[model samples]
Target: MIALLPLAVILPMIGAGVTMVASRRPRVQRALSVTALAAQLAVALIMLVVVDDRGPMVMHIGGWSAPFGITLVADRLAAFMLVVSTIVTLAVLIYSISQGRDDEEEDGTNSETPTSIFHPTFLILATGVSNAFLAGDLFNLFVSFEILLTASYVLLTLGGTTERLRAGAPYIVVSLLSSLIFLSGVAMVYAATGTVNLADLATKIDSVPPGIKATIAAILLTAFGVKAAVFPMSAWLPDSYPTAPAPVTAVFAGLLTKVGVYAIIRVQTLLFPGMFTTVLMVAAGATMLVGILGAIVQPGIKRMLSFTLVSHIGYMLFGVAIGSEAGVAAAIYYVAHHILVQTALFLGAGLIERVAGSTVLARLGGLAAAAPVLAVLFFIPAMNLAGVPPFSGFLGKVGLFEAALEGSTGAAQVLPLVIVCLGTLTSLLTLYAIVRVWGRAFWRPVPQAGEEHPPTGPLDPRGDHPMTTQYTESRRRAREAARRRMAAAEAARLPLGMVGATTAVVTVGLVLTVGAGPIYGLAERAAGNLMDQQTYVRAVMDTPADGAADLLIDPPGLSPAEPTAQDPGGTG
Candidate 1:
């Protein structure tokens, strides 16, 4: 079973090479990509089952042993993330293929178009995401980020339109800055402890001075916060994500930020336990309030959803801030829930664009009557995202709130309690924001000729509100252009494959809600394993301390506590 660990990371990379080689054959590339993702999902599920039955699984590359050779570890958290992420990537791939087919059919374009690059880059992206989850060392995790970021740059700028290039430029600059910080942090960790292995660092971090440890933690957290789009550092997300192709945007919004959140979870829990609770809690409250406020004022669907995405991340950070077993478990559950629901919503938004020819609320109307199926698809996920009752979103948030209340006491609990109230307010505001979109874009009657659609005014981020005539006129012209586009799109037929992929994603979101009980149970176990950090350290180092061998069987010829050549005190 240990051998299977590398396969999950390697198979997608192989698939990427094959797809690139077969770039001229669209059918072959599509088939190969789908097969690769399917196999990846299977491997992930098998790993999940194995890890659940047994414990964490570890693989040492090139027989060099831990702290020297590369290592891959799959605990319950890694396995679960792998399965969920693979499912999302596969769905998005199908949607993208359908989209490409539709574009070629409509435009009469040749096979050599930019769409040819999508499959290989997407596969490479999946491989990077898998590698990040399974990586056992800080340097390896940095490599994974670089892999995904390189692919993402291509995906973001695939069309090379002025808008996409503009968005991609800022995204690239921000990502590179974050990577630099991550690399610097890795170097510092190595210089301080003489080992980059996460398990080794876990044991050695305590010996470092408190000030240096705090500085390292701050640098690392800042880098990850930029990636995760936490408040004060999240202004880039809404502007950057809305310009990409719908499929690209969907996967980016769904999977990318969560990877950062996952890193924060691992770093906080494993590397620096109980270090910065107050700071995280304060950030959580600000993220929730600011994000929802931004969402409330956006006029575009994708931008609004993007802000909501940032807002809901606060919920996960809130869980991490609590720093308890239940808190971490709730966070794990919420992360899984958010990934599915956000992907579904974005895919549904794509379908809406296909039918309405625009995502601006002012230009879209009567969708409930013209495209009831698309409306249903959009409505379910929108409600789920807003934390509607009996949905996974609600359950996840409830779990987090409960955990926050239970995990702290007295004055230590005051901030979390305040954040909980603020979270509830954020939830209500989220519902209002989505419902506003639905009411204007779906429930309202289509505007007649010369009806003069009402203006909602510019989305003021600073709360200064005076509507300018020039701004209103610009909005009117945009709406008129959108109307013309919608008129043209009305003649085109919607693709069944695209709709089917969207429907499947939405159904998966529903499944999360229905299976919340069993899923949350799994999250609890994953969190339990995370809190018992010694178990992970032992598994990776092959050192079972004092009868710990009975809990998990290590591979043969793997010596326990082998000292590294670089640092005599470093534990393998």
Candidate 2:
């Protein structure tokens, strides 16, 4: 099983190559991609069970030991993240496959030209995600980010439509900037501690000056904050994501930002414990408020969901800010929950777009009467995201609030209290946004031309208000556009594969609710190990020289403070 740890990343890479070779055969490519992700998910689930019961496992690469060779460590947190992430990628892949086949069948040709790259690039992206989850060193983590971000560029601009290209340009620029920042931070980290291995740094970083340590931490956090789409840094996301293909948008919404959160959690817990609590708390509140505020005003489902996506990130950031086992535990569970729910909502949005011909609230209506299954799909995740009771979202939020209130203590109770209030406000606002979308996009009558009052202005010389003339003309244009979209979409049938994949994801989200006890227990245990520096450091650095023994079974002999021959001067 320890040896199989690397396979989580390897299988996907291998599949990417194989799928690329078989691209001429679309069916073969799809089969290979699905098979690869399924295998990766199996590996991830096995690791989750193994690490939870047996403690962390460390596999040194190429027979070389840690702090020198590449390392892959799977503790409860990494394993759990891997499991959730693979589930999402797999479901999205299936959805994408169905969408592609349906499009070709509808048009009787490959309307989406150059479709060959999609499968391979998608698998590579999966590989990158898996690598990131298991990466035991800073450099490898950076490499993983590059792998995924590069693949995303291709996925985002698929078909090279002008709209997609426009969206991808800023996305590319922002991504490149974030990558540069992350790379610089990695360099600074190495310059400070002479090691990029996370476990090794966990011990060595303390010896660095306080000023330098703080600078390094802040630099890394800023880069990760950008990737996670934390407020102020998040402006690029809503514009950038909504233009991609449905599966592309769904997967990006679900997995990419969470990876940034995962990095923040790993670094904060392992390298610099309790260092930026105040900053994180303040950021969490601002992100929640700003994100939801943007959400309520959006008239489109995709954009609204995108804003809510940014807003919910605040909840996870808040959990990390609380810095307690319970707080971190709740954050972990919420990350998993949000991944599933958000993906389902985006896929559901895709369905609504297919059925109604548009996601714009004014152009969409009466979906419940036409497609009740689609309505249910969208509704479940929407309510779950808004933290409605009895759902995993609600359970996760309650856990976070309980943790915050319980941990609130002398002289600093005010911050937690204030954040709690803001979080509660954010929740209500999120619910409001969801309800507005539900009412406008689902319950209202299907929009029809000539529903508005007749113009009595320039277009109709009897009009009293000139502004009304302009408003009426714009409405006329919008209605016409909606009609065209509907006319085109009317001939397309809803693909069962797409619906089934979304249902599977939504069902998994429900499972998080039904089995919240055991899952939260896993999260709690993962958080405990995360907060304990020794568990991770020992697993990575203290292994036996022969290295045949299971890391979980044999404790490392060397102390964290001592320098190995690998670092003769302790300043590599």
Taken over the whole model, the C-alpha lDDT of each candidate is: 0.86, 0.88
Give the winner by TM-score: 2
Question: In lDDT terms, how accurate is model 2?
Answer: 0.88
lDDT of 1 by residue, 1-572 (tens): 77668999999999999999998998999999999999999999999888887678887776656787677889889999999999999999888888888888878773322656989999999999999999999999999999999999999887788988898898999999999999999999998899989888999999999999998899888888888999988988999998888898999999999999999998999998888889998999999999999999998999999999999999999989899999999999999989988998898888878777789887777788778888899999899999999899999999999998984679888898999999999999999999999998888866543344544556578653356666566667766765675565555466877788888888988888989888898899889888988978988887232212322532223344644332246354
User: Lowest summed-lDDT stretch of 10 residues in model 1?
Assistant: 545-554
Query: Per-candidate RMSD vs. true structure?
Result: 7.1, 5.5
Which candidate comes out best when scored by lDDT? 2
Predicted candidate 2 versus true structure: per-residue lDDT over 427-446, tens digit per residue: 99999999999998788776
TM-score of 1: 0.90
TM-score for predicted model 2 compared with the true structure? 0.92
